[model samples]
Target: MKKFLAAAVFSCFSLSLFANSFSEEMLNIYAKLSVRFVLMSTLKDELSESVNICIGSKAEDERAATTLIDLMHEHYPAGIGEYKIYVIKSDYSNINFCKEASLFFVLSIEDIDLPKVITFAQENKILTMSYDQVLVEDGIDISLFIGREIRPYISLANIFAKDIYLDNVLLRVSKIYKKQEE
Candidate 1:
């Protein structure tokens, strides 16, 4: 009861932030859904006792990253499930700061800096989620496919490369992302 109420309130607050733009609205929706999908991962048990989520960004996206962390703290005061949530703000240059993270939510970053982050995440077996769906094709573990009904967009090859596994239920409903061959 209380849980449902809290989620409803949070959803309203989240959606309100990007109500002016359809694409921004989809991003907000995807951000919220990302939280739920974390629990559905088969590797959830391997996460730290206090799950560390790194909001990876460049200098330009610092404000957006901070806003996201603040919102997360406000809405998830009790953390999610039995795992305590710890949001860390990280810059692209200092990707090492996120080595302890279980999940890395990459904000809009330069193309050159992206591969470094992706490599780090893959090597650490940390789940990589992106704010932009286009990044999914670039080796991000997850994003949302904004269509008539939004759905999760996942890169199976990338996740597999990272030795990360999601539950079948999530995979069933997601749109598998395939990298384009040159």
Candidate 2:
């Protein structure tokens, strides 16, 4: 709990401001990072068909959720041309939400049951990610702000991809999780 608060405090600068206005600059960063991961982690030599990816409602009306959907949906083909990506909106619950996501984003701790979220993600072979303070404390993958930009990082130490492989192009985007003492 303490760790999460510290992380949230450090990252609050990027998230605390909510103008209800979407920033293209922010979206661009997300798009690039996501493209890097998708391309790198893809398990194929040739491009696969459309895959169903899920994003959670991290905010009321899910502003961040929509932003992610737009990023994945818009960038995949434009950036990789041969492959297609699909973003599924999560219902934010154990049963439906967890089931819907192949890649799940943690929006906020307040909106989730951490243990359940983690368990469901692992059991379902879903990749869990978050920008939430608490989930990060619990060692979930997260995207964080450095200066004005936030980037994706992960806790895949316990999570592994099988026949699926992550390529250098995507791994370049993932900064391995290293605990920083506050």
Error of 2 at 103 (Å): 1.2
Across 61-151, the per-residue lDDT of candidate 1 in tens digits comes to 6766766776676657788888788888888888898888888998667899889988999788888888778998877889877554467
Which digits, one per residue and each the tens of the lDDT, describe model 2 over residues 1-182? 66555545554435434434334455555555554454455333443564445665544637666766776666665535565666666655634644644456664445346677767766766556664434655755545443333455655553463224565554575555655663
TM-score of each: 0.81, 0.64
Which residue pairs does candidate 1 place in steric collision? none
Residue-level lDDT for 109 in candidate 1: 76
lDDT of 2 at 74: 67
Candidate that scores best on lDDT = 1
Candidate 1: residue 35 Cα off by (Å): 3.1
Model 1 residue 18 lDDT score = 35
